[model samples]
Target: MTQEDKINWLKENEPILWANTFKIAKGELSDKQTMFCCCGKLATGLHEDNCRKFLQQVKNETAKRLQEYIK
Candidate 1:
């Protein structure tokens, strides 16, 4: 799926995770802070399946922004 599709999926299915992930990606939240799952599981912010997917979307978005800067 496209980055936008991924984000929409997260927003619709996992609103809290989406919000936290976006804030953290945008540097609005400290990178050192831990992200917790709805079930209270500790998310590594990388390897956890949903977080990983979200992060890939974040990475893609960042790359796109950087490309804009280079243009």
Candidate 2:
């Protein structure tokens, strides 16, 4: 509830959190894209914010592709 409590909880649960986060994100990626993402994340380690960024990027691209397909 408190900031300290939140920080402690995150530290204590990081492995589980990391696993679940990757699991869900992996499910969302296409096979090729998933490999690319995994390589990037592994290379970047602590600074990888690609999960969120990639989702936004994919959504935008998908929308653009759909519009092009429709036209």
Candidate whose TM-score is highest: 1
What would the per-residue lDDT of candidate 2 be over residues 1-71, giving only the tens digit for each residue? 54344434443556465345444544455444533553455423232355666654444443333332221
Give the range of the ten consecutive residues with the poorest summed lDDT in model 1. Answer: 62-71
RMSD of each candidate relative to the true structure? 10.8, 13.3
Q: Write the per-residue lDDT of candidate 1 for residues 1-71, one digit (tens) a residue.
A: 56565555556766665566556564522243367642346755444445554455565554444332231
Q: Against the hidden true structure, what lDDT does model 2 obtain?
A: 0.44
Runs of candidate 1 with Cα error greater than 4 angstroms are 28-71
TM-score of each: 0.38, 0.32
TM-score of 2: 0.32
Model 2: worst 10 consecutive residues (lDDT sum): 62-71
| CA lDDT, every model vs. true structure | 0.51, 0.44
